[model samples]
Target: MNTEVPRLSVVVPVFNEQDVLPLFVERIRPVLDELGLTYEVVAVDDGSRDATPVVLGLLRRRWPQLRVVRLRRNSGHQSALAAGLRRARGQYLVSIDVDLQDPPEVIGDMLRLAQREGLDVVHGVRADRSSDSVFKRWTASLYYRLIQRMAGAAIPRHAGDFRLLSRTAVDALVALPEHLPVYRLLVPWLGLPSGEITYTRAPRAAGRSKYPVAKMIRLALDSIVGFSAAPLRVATWLGLIGIGICAVLAGAGVTAHLSGTTVPGWTSLLVALLFLGALQLLCLGLLGEYVARIFTSLQGRPAYVVAFDSATDAEPAEDALCRL
Candidate 1:
């Protein structure tokens, strides 16, 4: 790590954010400059179906320090972030969303904490999130609690991709091989000394949020199952409990029959059958998740394939280095 390099690489993953890019870049550049730090802005185009790429090209034309990386297909947010991390060339790396809800000015606070506190990672936490609707906020809170319970990680409630990482932390994260790594979970797995800077998340400036409720729910499920075995264990307990319930019911029915108090059993049997069937489906789904992850790992598939490289990076070509 070059401590004196004095360069901060700010990576923003864009997916159809053309309308907001201009404002994001304008607000961010000035804040970056105010930190007295040399920086490069990397905009990862995650196969935007809009005019995002054209707008990114316009920015690159205006500023030499602005760089754009274009992916051939829409790899999800995690993949886009992985690509940006691979291309980042700086002593410190800051990754955030293009929506700008995290605020650009917080970068200075993160940098100060990193340097003064000697922390390897600095995650920005939302001190108060009154801007979000009640349902959204409640779901967000529930998602974090569920992940913490299942993953047993200290991932903060409101932290997203808006964080600063030291050179070592960046390298460590990129070295990880999980195809669907939830960075929110991996940060704690790496066990780096870290601190947080509190800030209020701002509302979207334009172009609706990329993540709707469905996407948010899916992401939350992926994070919990990807990082921990608790889901499978819960499935096991559910299956066992279901069996126990059926056994007790059977015993009760047999006892009633022996006592000559037998009643028509169709309704009771039908209800038990339906309940057990649903339980079986839940268990199967959980098992399938683990099996799928293991099967993919055993198949030795690469996490991502670089369709093309527009910029040179320090590491060897990913194709040359990929062991999986």
Candidate 2:
């Protein structure tokens, strides 16, 4: 860890959030001021196509402590987060969404717990998340529990990216080299001195959520395969079960032929074949998913490509991105 200490560094991953920035800054500034601590807001511009950068430029001009990270293109949320963590200088780091759904004031509670309890990471768990749709709530519940059961890692339930980590925790996280990082899983695996604070997750101040069903499925698969080998094990188990079924059916067919009862119902045989074939394919597909992740990792591709950065406080680096 560096000898110089920063009181707090808030890393907000920005997407198409132009409408919310003005209100977000207004709400966050007073809370930080009340804490009476030196802080910096790392607003990560994750290749937003909206006026997000313009708003960030305005904010940076107004508040010198504001630091902006511009990704070369639209990296997913986790990659954008990884980019911000790479550049954070604070002794304690806080990760949040720019939507302002998680109140800025929650940081006060997290910081308080960190100081008083001497914890390495403080998680902000929502006491009530009913603001989300019923389907979303159900899926989220299932996803967290399934990850915990299958992954063998004790990821906190109801904990999103809204959390605070001490310098030690931050260092441990940054040392990890997995090209694809699922932050929720990685934090628990680090095994830090963790604590949780309860809060009400507010509805978004503007715009719909960035995470739709398809994105949620992608994230779930990444978390499961990235952290646990259970999926691969399941693939093995499924193949073994299929073999057992096939052997039993073959024996039955031989017995029928010997007894001279003669096999009847070609439809039944066809049904059995289809069912077994489907199972075989499903198991193979699961194996393929794990193999695909390994192949992607072996390629040594960065999780995110930073086309340009202005974190050093220079003029906007002209778009280095090329069109196809």
Candidate 3:
């Protein structure tokens, strides 16, 4: 490892991305090289089941500027990113993914903008996501809109994890006590001098997307529960509505009995009972989600465990020494 701190550290969290690693390196290395800044690429392997670890090992051997940090298990992408951020030793840290959907070339723009404006954070916002599938675009729009309504902070409309942070910003993020942090919300909550750079998001260069419907839903839940009390409030509203409906039904039953037209109907009564029961259950589930997060947080577990770090075993070399 270089004893001297680098000017920039580009952190990429990897899962089963064996096929895309080479292509990512091919595209990003040149951008860093042309910038003429001392930099290191810190790729955190989030316990890939494929040959990603082996590929990273070989890449590190040839590309001395590359450093690999392997996690003990698959702890998800955000956790892996947190690991990289904590390990980064640079004046500025840039976090991007290996899929190349968020263009690596934009890093130059982010760096320039940050330096020019004296900003602590530079977010790469997707100006156009026409390249993505219709479903992806729709869900992304909904997620951002929902977060804006519920979260206590204002997250950029179309920003993902592709962002640049100064040392101060990185330190603030790393110091946060969240075990499953939603960086999009947490970063904005920090109240830093941040700017945005617009880019047309490109399609993935290789391999399948890691985030599927289930994972996306999980991410949304984590973000909502971690950063807002809206779910609990919604639960409260549901309970109130259920009570009001029950009272209305009781009043109708009393009026019918007084008028000598009380119809004995088990079906309607059963339906109303079932509906209220279901609503109560749903409210309880929502409260449980928040309670679960609180319980997990109090456990004080590390987000990810690193099995290996290439920097500890390898010597550092000049930036962008290896080329495709």
Candidate whose TM-score is highest = 3
Enumerate residue pairs that collide in model 1: none
Q: Which clashing pairs does model 2 show?
A: 72-307
Cα displacement (angstroms), candidate 3, residue 217, comes to 0.1
**Tens digits of per-residue lDDT for model 1, 1-324:** 232344799888899998999999889888987888788877888888998876776776566677777787887888788888888888999999988788999999899999999999999898888888899899989988888878888787788888999999999998887788778779877999999999998888788988898888779878977888898889989988998998999899889999999988598888998999999999899899889888988999655555444354342243233333
Poorly placed runs, candidate 2 (over 4 Å): 1-5, 317-324
* Per-residue alpha-carbon lDDT of candidate 3 for residues 1-324, written as tens digits (9 for 90 to 100): 468799999999999999999999988888899999899999998989997877787677777799888899999999999999999999999999999999989999999999999999999999999998899999999999999999857799999999999999999998887889889888999999999999999889999999999999999999898888999899889888889989998999899999999877899889998998899899889989988888888888887898878777542232123322
The models' CA-based lDDT, in order, is 0.83, 0.86, 0.90
Over all chains combined, what TM-score does candidate 1 have? 0.92
- Superposed on all Cα atoms, the candidates' RMSDs to the truth, in angstroms, are 5.7, 3.7, 3.5
lDDT, model 2, position 292: 92
Query: Looking at candidate 1, what is the lDDT of residue 301?
Result: 64
By lDDT, the better pick of 1 and 2 is: 2
Tell how far residue 145 is off in model 1, in angstroms: 0.7
Ranking by lDDT: 3, 2, 1
Candidate 2 versus the native: TM-score?
Answer: 0.93
Which lDDT tens digits does candidate 2 get at residues 1-324?
Answer: 133456999999999998999899999989988988888888888999987877787777777777878887898999999988888889899999988889999999899999999999998888899898999899999999999899878788999999999989988888998788999889988888899998999999988789989999999998988888898788788878878988898898899899999757899689888988898788888888888988998999887776545556446633211110
What value does the lDDT take at residue 279 in candidate 1?
93
